[model samples]
Target: MITIQDIRNAQENIQDTINATPILQSGQLSQLCRNQVFFKCEHLQKTGSFKIRGATNKVKQVVMEGAKLVTAASSGNHGQAVSFIAQQLGVPATIVVPTDVNPCKMNAIDAYDGNIVKCGTTSAERIPRAIEIAAEQNGLFIPPYDDPYIMAGQGTTGLEILEQVQDVDAVIVPIGGGGLISGILTAIKETNPNIKVYGVEPETANDTFLSFQNGRITSITPTSTIADGLRATQPGDMTFPVMQKYLDDLVLVTDEEIRRAFSVVMERMKQIIEPSSAVTVAALMNKKLPLEGKKVVTVISGGNVDLARISELMIGTERIY
Candidate 1:
C-alpha cells in the first residue's frame, strides 16, 4: 500500500525534474456551476502531461540502482514520458505501443530516441510484448500506472493542488488505468480526509466506474472513444484498491460530452487539452457530481493532441456561450 511518506519522498525525488503546474480559477465555469472552479493545469506539465512526474521518479530510482536499460508500454502519453525521461537520464529505453496510438505521441517518442515497438491494440498485447523485450534486454520494466513509485510520483499533483487551492471541497480527476487518481486520492485523503475526490471516465471506457460500482476489479471489452488515453480495459492491481478505498464516486461521460468539454476549454479557457483530460470537465458540465456552492478542482491531465483531429471532434458540438 502507498503511504503519505512515499508521496512526500516522491515529491522530493522529482522536485527539480517536474513542473509545479499552476492552479487557475475558471471564471466562466465558476459562473456556470455556481461554484469556485479551479483547474490544475497538468496539460502544461512536461511532456504535455502529468505522466512525466511518475516516469522521471521511476527512471531515477532504477538508474540510481545501476539500471542501464528500461522498458515501458503505453498507448501514447506514458510511452513518451518514459522515453523522454529515460533518454535524459542516459538510460536506454524501449517503448511498446498499440498500433492505433496517436501519431503525435508516436512522433514524440521517436524524438526522445526511444526504440519503438508496435504491437496489437490493447494493453494485453502491448504489455506482454514490452515485458518480453525488457527480459531480452535485461532491463527494468516501468508499467504506466501500476507501480508504487509511479503512484507516489503522481501524488505530487495532489500535493500541489492542496497548496494551490485552499478550502477545496472536491477534486475531480480523469481515470484510465487509475494511476493519477490513485496518487491524488492518497495525497488528498490522507492529508485532508474531508475533501472529496471524484473520478471521471469516458462511458465507453468505464472500467474504473464499473470496478467502483461492482466493489471489485471489473473490466470491459476495449472500446474506442475520443478520450483515447482512458482506454484501459481494467484498473491496475495496486491502483484499484487505493481507488476503492478513497474515491468518493466515479462518473461516466459520453464521447459527445467529452468533445463538448474539449471545445469549451479551447474556446473559453484558451487551453488545449486532449479528450482524456477533458472528461473531468465533462462530468462537471453535465452535472454528474454534486458541486453546488463548493470549491472544486478539476485536473486537466494532458494536452498532447493531434491537431488534425480537432476539427473532426468539434464538427457537431455547439460551443458553450
Candidate 2:
C-alpha cells in the first residue's frame, strides 16, 4: 500500500530536480464554469509534464540500486520523462512504445536519447515487452504507474496545489493509468481531508471510471479520441486501490468536450495543453461537476499535442459551431 510517507520521501528526493509548476487562476474558465478555477499547469514542467517528477525519482532510485539499464512502456509522456531523466542521471534507458505511437512523443524520446523499442500498438501489449526487455538486459522496470515512487512523484503536484491555493474546495484531475490521480488524492486527502478530489476521464476512454464502478480492474477497448494520453486500457493494481480510498468522484467527458477545452486553454490562458490534460476543464465547463461558486483546481497534465491535430481540431470546432 502506498502511504503518504512515500509521497513525502519522493518530495525529498525530487525537490531540486523538477519544476514546481504554477497554479494560476483562469479568469475565463472561472467565468464559464461559475467557479474560481485554478489551473495547475504541469504542461509547463520539464519534458512537458508532471511525469518528470516521478520519472526523475524512479530513475534515481533505480540508479542508486546499481541498475544500469531501465525499461518502461509509454505512448509518449512517460517515455519522454523516463528517458530524459535517465539521460540526466547517466543511465541507459529503453522505452517500449507502441509502433503506432504519436510522432510528437516518439520525437521527444529520441530528443532525450532514449533507445526506442517499437512494440505492439496498445499499452496492454507493450507492457509485457518492457518486462521482457527488463529481464533480458537485467534492467529495472519503471512503469508509468503501478510503482510507489512514481505515484509519489505525481503526488508532488497535489502538494504544490495545496500550498498555492487556500481553502480549495475541489481538485479535478485527468485519469489515465491512475498514477497522477493516485498521487494527488493521497496528498490532498492527507493534507486537507475536506477538499473533494475528482477524477476526470474522456468518455471514449473511461477505464478508470469503469474500474472504480466495477470494484476491479476493467479493460476498455480504446476508441478514437483526441485525448491520446487518456487511452490506457486498464488501471494498475496499486493505483486503483489508492484511488478507491481517496477520490471523491469520477466524471466523464466526450472527445468534443475535450477538444473545446483544449482550444479554450490555448485562447484564454494562452497555454498549450493536450486533449487528455483538458478533460478536467472540459468536465467543469460541461456542468458535469457541481462546482459553482467553489474554488476548484484542475491539473492540466501535458502540452504535447501535434501541430496538425490542433489545426484540425480548431477548424473542426469552428465548422461545427
Candidate 3:
C-alpha cells in the first residue's frame, strides 16, 4: 500500500512536467448544492486531463532507469497523457487504443508522435494486448490505473485540494478503475481523516459501489454511458483496497443526470467539461449524499470531448441563451 510519502514523492517527480491546475468556484453551483463548492479544474491540465500526472510520474522514473520505450492501453485520455509525456522525454510510445477510439484523441496522440496500434474495443481486450506489445518490444508498460506510481501520482490532486481549499469539509470524485478516488482517499485520510471523500460512478459503471456492497472486489460489464471515463468493468486490486479502507461512501448517477450536469456546466459555468467530469457535478446537483452546508470540492477530471458532440450532450437541458 502507498503512503502519503509516496504521493509526496510523486508530486516532486511530476512537478516539473505536470501542471498544478487551478481551483475555481462557481457561485451558481455553490448556491445549488448549498455548500461552499469549489471545482478542481484538472480539465485544464496538460493533455486536457489529470492522467498526465500519473503518466509523467511513471514515465519519468522509468526513463531514468534507462527505459527507451513506453506502452499503454487506453480508450483516449490515458493514451494522450502517455504520448505527450513520452514525446517530451524523447522516448518512443506505443499506445494500443480501442478500434473505435475518439478521433480527436487519436489526433492528439499523433501530434505527440505516439505509435498508434488499433486493438479490440473495451479495456478487457486491449489491456492484455498492450502488455504483450510492451513485452515484445522490450518497452515499459505504463498502466492506466492499477499501478502504485500511478495512484501515488493521482493522489497529488488531493494534496493540491488540501492546500487550495480553505475549509474543505468533503470531496466528491468520479471513480472508474478507482485510481483517482483511491489516491485521493489515501491523501485525505492519512492527513485529515475527518474530511469525507465520496466516490461517484455512473449507474452503468457502478463496479466500485458494488464492490463496497459485497465486501470485496467485484466485476460488472458496464453498460454504455456518456461518462466514458467511468466505464471500467471492475476496480483494480491495488486501488479497490484503498477505496475500501478510506472512502466514506460511494454514489451512483444516471447518464441523464450526467447530460444535465454537462449542460449546466457548459451554459452557466461556461466550462466545457467532458461528461466524465460532469459525473461529479451530477452527483452533487442531484444530492446523491448529504453534504448540505459543507465546504466541498469536486474534481473535474477532464475536458477532452469532440466539439461536434457538444450540442448532442446538451440535449434535454434548458439553456439561458
Candidate 4:
C-alpha cells in the first residue's frame, strides 16, 4: 500500500519536472451549481495531462537505479506522458497503444521520439504486449496504473488541492483505472477525513462504480464512450482497494452529459478540456451528489482531446447553462 510519505517523496522527486497546476475558482460553474466550485486545472500540466507527474517520477526512479529503457501501455495520455518524460531523462521508451488511439496523442509520442507499437484495443492486450516488449528489450515496464510509484506520484495532485483549497468540502475526480482517484483519495482522506471524495465515470464505462457497489472488484464487457480515457474495463487491483475504502460516493454520467459539460467549460470556463476531464464537470452540472452551497473542487484531468473530433461531439447536444 502507498502511504502519504511515499506520495510526499514522489512530490519531491518530480517537483522540478512537473508543474504544480493552479486550482482556480470557477465563478460560472459555481453559480450554475449553486456552490463555490474550484477547478483543479491539471489540463494545463505538461503533455496536457496529469499523467506526466507519475510517468516522470516512475521513469526518474528507475533511471537513477541504472535503467536504460522503459515501456508502457496507454490509451493516449499515459503513452504521451511516459514518452515525454523518458525523452527528457535521456532514456529510451517504447509505448504500446491501442489500434484506435487518438492521433494527437500518437503524434505527441512520436514528437517525443518514443517507439510506438499498436496492438489490440484493450488494456488486456496492450499491457501484456508492452510487458513482452519490455522483457524482450531488457527494459522496465511502467504500468499506466496499478503500481505504487504511479499512485503515489498522482497523489501529489491531492496535496495541491488540499493546499490550494484549505476548506474544501468535497472533491470530484474522474475514474479510469482508478489511479488518479486512488492517489487523490489517499491524500485527501488521510490529511482530512472530513472532506468528501467522489468518483465519476461515463455510464458506458462504469466499472469503478460497479466495483464500489459490489464490495469487490468487478468488470464489465468492454464498452466505448466519448471519454476514452475513462474506458478501462475494470478498476486496477492496487487502485480498487483504496477507492473502496476512501471514496464517499461513485457517480455515472452519459456521453450526452459529458458533451454538454465539455461545451459548458469551453464557453463559460474558457477551457478546452478532453472528454475524460469533462466527466468531473458533468457530475457537478447534473447534480450527481448533494453539493449545493458546499465548496467543491473538480479536477479537469487533461486537455489532449483531438481537435478534429470536438465539432462532432458538440454538434447536436444542447449546452445547458
> TM-scores of all models?
0.98, 0.96, 0.97, 0.98
Model 3 C-alpha lDDT per residue in residues 1-321, reported as the tens digit of each score: 889999999999899998889998888888877888899999999999999998998999899999989999998899999999999999999999888777888889999999999987677777899999989999989999999999999999999999999779999999988778888898989999999999899998888888989999888873678887777888999999999888888989998889888888887789999899999889888989888999999999999998888888985544321
lDDT per model vs. reference: 0.91, 0.88, 0.89, 0.91
Clashing residue pairs for model 1: none
Model 3 poorest ten-residue lDDT run: 312-321
The total number of steric clashes, by the backbone 3 Å criterion, in model 1 comes to: 0
State which candidate, 1 or 2, has the greater TM-score.
1
In candidate 1, what are the lDDT values of residues 1-321, reduced to their tens digit?
A: 899899999999999888999987778888876788899999999899999999988999999999999999999999999998988888898999999889999999999998999998878778988999989989989999999999999999999999999899999999999999999999999999999999998999888888877889997886889998999999999999999889899989999888888888887788889999999988888899987999999999999999888887663435564
Clash pairs (backbone) in predicted model 3: none
How well is each residue in 138-221 modelled by candidate 4, as lDDT tens digits? Answer: 999999989999999999999999899879999999999988999999999999999999999999998888887788889898
- The true-versus-predicted C-alpha distance at residue 234 of model 1, in Å, is 0.5
The clash count for each model shown is 0, 0, 0, 0
Error of 3 at 311 (Å): 0.9
Better of 2 and 3 by TM-score: 3
Q: What is the TM-score of candidate 3?
A: 0.97
- Superposed model 3: Cα runs more than 4 Å off: 316-321
Alpha-carbon RMSD of each model: 1.1, 1.5, 1.4, 1.1
Off by over 4 Å in 1: 315-321
Model 4 regions more than 4 Å off: 315-319
lDDT of 4: 0.91
